[model samples]
Target: MIELKSAGELDAMRLAGKVVATALRAVAAGAAVGTSLRELDEIAAGVLADAGARSSFLHYQPGGAPSPFPAVLCTSVNDAVVHGIPNGYRLRDGDLLSIDFGAEVDGWHGDAATSFVVGTADQRDLDLIAVTERALAAGIDAARPGNRLGDIGHAIGGIGRAAGYGLLADHGGHGIGRAMHEPPSVPNEGVAGKGLRLRPGMVLAIEPMLVAGGGDSYRPAEDGWTLCTFDGSRAAHAEHTVAVTSDGPRVLTTE
Candidate 1:
């Protein structure tokens, strides 16, 4: 069931959000050419531990194939869309690296992700990331108290469609409060003015994943976690944990 958070609960989520945002910032900064993906995961793990928070993603299993996830940070590069496990692969020029991180504080969860182009980037790659970033902003704007869940999804998905990119349908956003994955699944594509009604104190993690080749299909990696585009096209993902507020959408993931 979708649950409304109290002010106290919102405050706890805010703290967790900060931890995630800070860690993501540090990881992105260190994602230079030649940096190992595993190294970035270690950096994020230390940051979460130092903040006295725990990873919402580490060792997490969500009705998948094998065991729990091994890494705290998701290092999705190039055609890899989401849940890209960190490994010994090193960053390279023109690589579209998407890092997704989640942290828990006092049981509340914060989740966010960002895509970065290592060294240099191609025009198509830059456009993918830019559109995904703008899509996230559109979703946040639509997460108002009176808006329906479809409004948020429509806003996000519309941008990718306008950009001629393919929106991943299977994996979308979700309501996030005490748990990493909660009720009110937030899709990247939907009709506006449809779906559940938004209420104040409802926290959600809105993420938009897009593929450059105008195809939405994806295949699971052999690791049983990472999802990559079927057409071998580059992809980008952007996300933020936000709260529906009376004044407006309160973005909890910030510096």
Candidate 2:
């Protein structure tokens, strides 16, 4: 069932969002050339521990998964799109890294993701990340009362399509509340004025996953977790937890 959060519950979720934002920032800053993905995971764990928040990604076993996720953060690099398990792989210069993180505070949950280059970035990769971030902002901006869920998706997809990037299929945003994944699967592409109508208490995580290969084809890695583009092209993912309020769309996950 879709659970509409109250004012107090939104506040609690915002607290959790703050924890997630801090952890993401720390992991991004610590992600330098030669830095192992495991080390970046440790950096996020430290931030969560310092804030007395628990990781929502750690040990999370969604249905149909091979095993429980073993890391605090999803570190997808280069071709890997999402759910990339953190390992001992050391990042090289120009490696595109995507970090996805979630945190729970006082029973509330918040999730977000960011993608960036490790050291020296190619101009094409930089443009890819920039457009992905813009898509995320557009999605968040569309989360307002009287707007349908499709509007949000349309806003996001329009940007990606205009840039000639491929939007990842089958994986999109979701409702976030007491649990990490809730009801209402938010799509990254749709026709406006369709789907569920936006309510004031609704909170959704709008994420845009874009592939630079200009196609939507992707395959799961041998590990059964990490997803890579079929053409081995790089990808970028961006997200934010937004609250549909009367005034405007309030982005909970921010630094």
Candidate 3:
């Protein structure tokens, strides 16, 4: 069922969203050459602890996952697309890192993801990250009331197609509220005017996953959590949790 947030519930979501945003910022800021992925996970866990927030990703096991996620952060490095497990791997110069994080506060859930480079980034990697962020912004822009859910995906997918990037449309965004994932599967590629109609209080997480290579295929790594690209090409992912309002769209997660 698609649940709408009341004013008080929206306030609760914002509080949870702020915790996620702050933790993401902390994790991103700690992404440096020679920094271990485990270290980044620690940074996120520390932030959540201080804010009285609990990690939604930790111990979360979906159907496809081999086991419950053990860490607070999903640290995808380079060709590792999404759901990357944080481990003892150390960051290197020119490595592109994508951190997907979610947190819960007072029983409300907030989620977001960001992609960045560790040190001196390659121009190709820089362009990919920029494009992913723009796609996220475009999706958020189309979240106004009266718009269809497909419009959000259409706007995001168009950018990737125009740039000749491979999109992971199969694993797109989803509705998020009291739980980490919910109804209304928001695809990254769809007809602009199709899918569920947007309305006030309907909150959705819009994320765009783009790969530099032609293939969109990925596989689960041996770690039982990370998803890696089939051809070993780098990928970028960016996301924001937004709510449709009577007047327009209200973005709840922002730094």
Best by lDDT: 2
Off by over 4 Å in 3: none
Better of 2 and 3 by TM-score: 2
Rank the candidate models, highest lDDT first: 2, 1, 3
Across 1-255, the per-residue lDDT of candidate 3 in tens digits comes to 899889789888999889999999999889989999999999999999999999999999888777899998999999999998898999999999999999899999999999999999899999999999999999999998888988998999899888989887478999999998999898888898998998889999999999988578887788877788888999999988898888677778875
lDDT accuracy of residue 220 in candidate 3: 78
Candidate 3: worst-modelled 10 consecutive residues by lDDT: 246-255
Which regions of candidate 1 deviate over 4 angstroms? none
RMSD (CA, angstroms), candidate 1: 0.8
Better of 1 and 2 by lDDT: 2
Q: What's model 2's TM-score?
A: 0.99
TM-score for all models, in order of appearance: 0.98, 0.99, 0.98
| Preferred candidate (TM-score higher): 1 or 2 | 2
Q: 25 in model 1: Cα distance from truth in Å?
A: 0.7
lDDT of 2 by residue, 22-106 (tens): 9999998999999999999999999999999999999999999999999999999999999999999999999999999999999
Model 2: colliding residue pairs: none
Q: How accurate locally, in lDDT, is each candidate?
A: 0.93, 0.94, 0.90
The segments of candidate 2 whose C-alpha lies over 4 angstroms from its true place after superposition are none
Clashes of each: 0, 0, 0
